[model samples]
Target: MRGVVMYAPGDVRVEDVEEPTILAPTDAIIALSATCICGSDLWPYRGADDVDEPFHMGHEYVGIVEEIGDAVRTIEPGQFVVGSFFASDNTCEICRAGYQTSCVNREVLGTTGRAQAQRMRVPLADGTLVATPGIPSDDLVPSLLAASDVLGTGWFGAVAAEAGPGKTVAVVGDGAVGLMAILAAKEPGAERIIAMSRHGSRQRLAREFGATDVVEERGAAGVARIKELTGGLGAHSVVEAVGTQESTMQAIASTRPGGHVGYVGVLHGVELRGDDVFMTHVHLHGGPAPVRRFLPELIDLIWTRKINPGRVFDLELPIDRAAEGYRAMDERTAIKVLLRP
Candidate 1:
């Protein structure tokens, strides 16, 4: 088996790795069909987060089940499935409340091992893996893979912000997740969607995904643009897809007094001042998205071709050329990179 590993910042390699096997009765092993690099993975890749030792990379995945442990009842071999980054028992109270990422028995896959491989073990198989109607055509693989993480995360961001009919939504950041948020806002009938991005390419895609307007400003200027578009009331909901202090505040300040801010960015070194938020009268919500909760619905949408979230992948590379993919993303030459395992 081959998998991607980062030995140090700017040092990523695809090399022979140990094959995975089911260690728990609730586990299943899947032959990954596709995987991809996530923006969060860049934290350590850029040396922002420490990389003291060799680290396994990748979390987003879609594949065919190869084997399942005895207790894995719902998921079986031959089923093409999409999985979340978090392996959860789905039966827990937290999961039942639609926050499977906080399940009592949860395992973070990227930290636990690697999904950027030909095959990998998935714990709590029945709970975390959602099978499609049938084995999908090759053309649908990438979109199905997107549902595993980015799409689900972006959908969660929109839901947390309460984006729906009659709501004006503003999304901060032009990353994959942010673009997906634009698609999500459109699906739910948001009256207006403002995509705040400085990149022309991302802005074009954002509009295609249903952004009614584009704001290429930053900080206070960005907030003002959003306010101006909404007649000085700001947007009804704002989705912050960049985990930075500036982006977070921009989201908060761009929302109307009673609006919501759903932040889905993996917080890097973000901090907030109590005084700054106390008078905002905005509802703040979001964290690691409970992707499992939305997997089933998202899978259906993908299977039906209602959305094409996989278009986020502007570049595709073989797993062996993962290092190049990382460099392309780091240098802003690619919006998102998809890896064929």
Candidate 2:
């Protein structure tokens, strides 16, 4: 089988690799129906995160189960499923509390599962994989794939920010996750949604997803703009989808006292000032999104065609051209790249 491997920063290649096998009674092997590149994949690709040697890449996936271990019960062969980046035992105390990403027995995929291939082994199959209503048509594949990670992550960010009716929401990033956050905000009937973005394309998508206002500035200027739009009290809920120091600060500063801030972007070199946060009086919540907790609802929305999150994929490429997909995303030529396996 061929899979993507990052030999080093700026050096991604599709190389033949050994196929995955069921290594645990709770595991299942699935033939990937679709997969895509994540913005966080750029962390190591741009050399932000360390990479001393070659390793498999890609985490977001939607696939058909080809085989299931004897112990697996909920998931079975031939069923189409959506799963998150983390493989977890959904019955754990933490997972039962709606934080499956922090489950007691959790496994990291993408770095270990090598999902950017034709097939991969899913750990804790019964807990991690959620079967779709039925085998979907080709048109539903991308949206189902989005539910696997980005949609769920964005939904988590919005929930963390406590977006809801009669509250103003501000998102501090224009990436796929940020855009999805707009959808999440709108789904819960949030009013006066604001999206902070400089790119015209992303700005348009933000509005399409329910953003009523757009702020082109960033950092302090962006914070000021958000306040200006909110009548100087700041917004009631702010979502930080860009995990940079500047974006994080902007999100916190853009929120009013007693508001909430959801930081979802993968933090690379972020350090929050204690005094600043102390003075802000904002409720903070976010980490690797408990995507599993939201998978059922997100999948239902997609399956019912109530949302079109798949439009986020502006670029599509064959799995063999995965290096190109990474370059396109790194260069910002594409919002999200869908890789056909």
Candidate 3:
């Protein structure tokens, strides 16, 4: 099988690799129907995240089950399924509380060899995978794939930020996750959604996703814009989707006292000041998104065409062209890139 491998910064290649097989009874193998590069993937591609050794890349995927281990009973060969980036036992105490990403027995997909291949192994199949009601049309594949990661991460951010009726929500960053966060905030009845973005294309999409205002400023200016829009009280909820010191501080400063901050960005050299957070009195929460917890509802929404998160994929490429997909995202020429294997 051929998949993407990152040898170093700006060096992604498509190469043949060994095929995957079920090594554990809880595992299942799936032939990828669709997969995509993620913003997090750029961390190493840009040399911000160390890539000491060449390794497989990509996590978001939707595919058809080709084989199942003896312990995997719910899913069978030929069933189309979507799974979270982190494979969890789902039966663990933490998972039961809706934090599957922190499950006692969790394995991150695509660590050894990722999902950006013809086929891949999924651990804890019963707990990690969710099957569609039936095989879906090709048209629905992209949106279903988004539920595997980006969309789910955005949803978790909104939920953690307490976006709901009468709440004013602000989102930091204009990446796919941030855009989806706006969509998620809208679904929950947020009274006002403020999107921080300097890009015109992203601003347009943010408004379409229910952002009532777009602030192009950053740092203190961005915080002032949020306060101005909210009559100096600041937003009741803020979603931080960029993992940087500036973006994190902007998000924290944009929320009203006692408001919640849901940060979903994969932290890259970020260190929050304890005293600053203590003084702000903002409730901060977010880590690897518990995508499994929201997969069922998100799938139902996508299946019914109630939402179209797949619009994020402005670029699509063959799996063999995974390097181009990565470059498109790094250059900001594409919002998200979908790969067809």
Candidate 4:
């Protein structure tokens, strides 16, 4: 089998690797038919994470079940499934509370490097993978794959920020997750959606996703635009999708006092000032998205073609062109890259 491997910063190669097998009674093996490059993958690729030599790459995947462990009864071979980036047993205490990302026995998919390979192991099979209602047509594959990560992350961001009826929402970044956050806020009946985007393409997509306004400003000016649109009150909810200090600041400033800020960017060395956050008195919550909890709902939307998240995937290439996909995203030429194995 072949998988994407990162040997050094800016060095991504698709090379032959061992195929995964069911390692536990609750594990399942999936043959990936589709996968994609995530913005988070760029962190290590850009030398931010100090990735060791020859690390396994990629987490977002949608595939077919080739085999299941002895204990896996609900999902059988040949079933098409979409899973969270992190595998969690749905019956755990935290999972029961709808926080599957913190499941006691969680296993992050693809951390073991074999994920980019043709076949990968999925632990806690019964809880992690959600089978689509039926075999989907080929066109729906990309959207279903998005549901595995970006869409789920965006939905979680909106929920964390309390985006709902009669409230104005602001999104801090224009990446795929941020675009989906716009859609997610609209789903919950948010009255007004403001997206901070300088890129014309992203801004257009944001509007299509239900953003009522697009702020082309950055930094302080951008925050002011959001506040100005909301009549100096800022937005009731803000979604932060970029992990940098500036993006976080923009998200906080664009939100009003007593509003909520949901941040899901993989935090780096940046810190939030305690005084500012305390004085703002706004709610703050977000982490690695509990994608498992939203899996079923998102799948239904995709299956029915209610939301066409596949639009976020601007580039498609064979798995062998994985490096090009990474480069396009790194250069900001592509919003998201979809790869087929």
Candidate 5:
């Protein structure tokens, strides 16, 4: 099989690799129908995160089950499925509490190899994979794929931010996750959704996703804009989708004293001051999104055409062009890139 491998910063290649097989009874093999690049993938591509050795890349995927281990029962050959980036035994105590990403027995996909390939192995099949009602049309594939990661991450952000009826919500960052956060905020009845975006294209999409206001500012200025829109009280909930010191601080500062801050960005070089947080007086929560917890509802929504999170995919290419997909996203020329294997 052929997949993406990162040898170093700005050096991505499509190369031959060994195929995957079920090494665990809980595992299943999937032939990828679709996969895509993620913002987090850029961390190493840009040298922001160390890549001491060449490794596989990509996590978000939607595919068909080709084979299942003896222990796997719920899913079978020919069933289309979507799965979270983090594989977990959903029966764990933490998973039962809706934090599958932190399950006692958890495994991250793509660490062993990339998901941007013709086929891959999924462990803990019964717990980690969600089978679609049936094989979906090609049009629905992208949106279903988004539920595997970004859509779920955004939903988690909204839930963590406490977005609901009568609440004013603000989102920092305009990436795919942030845009989907805007959509998630809307679904829960947020009274006002403020999107912080400097890009015109993103701002337009944010409005379509239910952003009532767009703040084309950053740092203190951005905080001020959010406060101004909220009559100086700040937003009741703020979703931080960019894992930068500036965006984190901006999100913390943009919330009211008693508001909540849900940060989902993969932290890059962030360190928070204790005193600063103490003064802010806001509840903070977020980590690897428990995507499995929200997959059912999100899938239902997508299956019914209630939300179109797949619009985030501004570029689509063959799996052999995975490097171009990565470059398009890194250069900000594309919001998200979809690769067909």
Candidate 6:
């Protein structure tokens, strides 16, 4: 088996590794059909985060169930499934409360520097993986994979921001998550979706997704544009998909008083001023998206073709060339890169 490993910043490789096996009765092994690189993975790749030597990379994936442990009954071998990045028991107190990301038995895949291999073990199979109604057509694989993370993260961001009918929504970032945030806003019937974008392709996709307006400016200027478009009132909800001080400020500044701001960007040396947020009276929320909770609904949407998120992938590469995929994203040559194992 070959999996992606990053020895250090700017040093990623695909090499042979031992295949994972079901370690528990509830475990399952998946043969990855497709996997993709996430923006958050770039933080360490760019030397922004302190990643110790030799760690497995990648969290978003979709695949076939190659084997299942004895305790797993709901998911069986040969079933196509989409899994969330965080593994949860689905029976824990937190899982019952719908915070599956925080389940006491939760585990984050790939951070151990051991994910992205040809096959990987999934813990708590029944609770973490959602099977499509049947073996989906080949074209649907990427969208199904999107449900595993980006789509779910975007959905959580919109929900956290309180996007709904008659509300003005603003998204801070032009990445896949941010673009999907625009789509998420539409499902909730948001009257207006304003995406803060500087890239032409992302801005166009933002509009296609449901962005009523695209603000090319950054910082205060962008915030002002949002307010201007909303009749002196900022957006009622804002989704912060970029985890940085500037993006956080943009999210808060572009949102109306008492509005909610959902931030899901992996925080990287970013801090928010309590006094500022308090004075603004904005409701702030967000963390790792509770992807496990939305798996069923999102899977249905993908299966039905109500939304096609596969357009996010502008480049594709073999798993062996995973480093090029990472570099393409880091250099902004591709919006998102899909890797075939």
Models 1 onward score TM values of 0.99, 0.99, 0.98, 0.98, 0.98, 0.97
- Lowest lDDT sum, 10 consecutive residues, model 3, at 108-117
**In angstroms, how far off is 204's CA in candidate 4?**
1.4
For each candidate, what is the lDDT? 0.92, 0.92, 0.93, 0.89, 0.92, 0.88
Encode model 2's per-residue lDDT on 41-143: one tens digit a residue: 8888999888888989989999999999999999989999999999999998999999999999999884544889999899999899999999999999999
The candidate that achieves the highest lDDT relative to the unseen native structure: 3
Q: Write the per-residue lDDT of candidate 3 for residues 135-160, one digit (tens) a residue.
A: 99999999999999999999999999
lDDT at residue 294 of model 4 (Cα atoms):
95
Error of 3 at 66 (Å): 0.4
Residue 274 of model 3 has an lDDT of: 92
Q: Model 4, range 1-341, lDDT digits (tens) per residue? A: 87899888899999987778778999989889798999888888898877776877878888999999999978888999999888889998999999999999998764433566577888898999999987789999999999989999999999999999999999988999999999999997999998888999899999998999888898999988888898898899999999799999888888899999999877677799998878887898999999999999999988988898888999999898999999999999999999899
Clashes of 2: 0
Q: What does candidate 5's lDDT look like per residue over 1-341, in tens digits?
A: 98888999899999998898989999999999999999888888999878898888878889999999999979899999999999999998999999999999999774333688889899899999999999999999999999999999999999999999999999999999999999999998999999999999999999998999999989999998888998898999999999999999999999999999999997777999998999888999999899999999999999999999998888999999989988899999999999999
Worst 10 residues of 4 by lDDT: 109-118
Residue 201 lDDT in candidate 2? 96
Model 4 clash number: 1
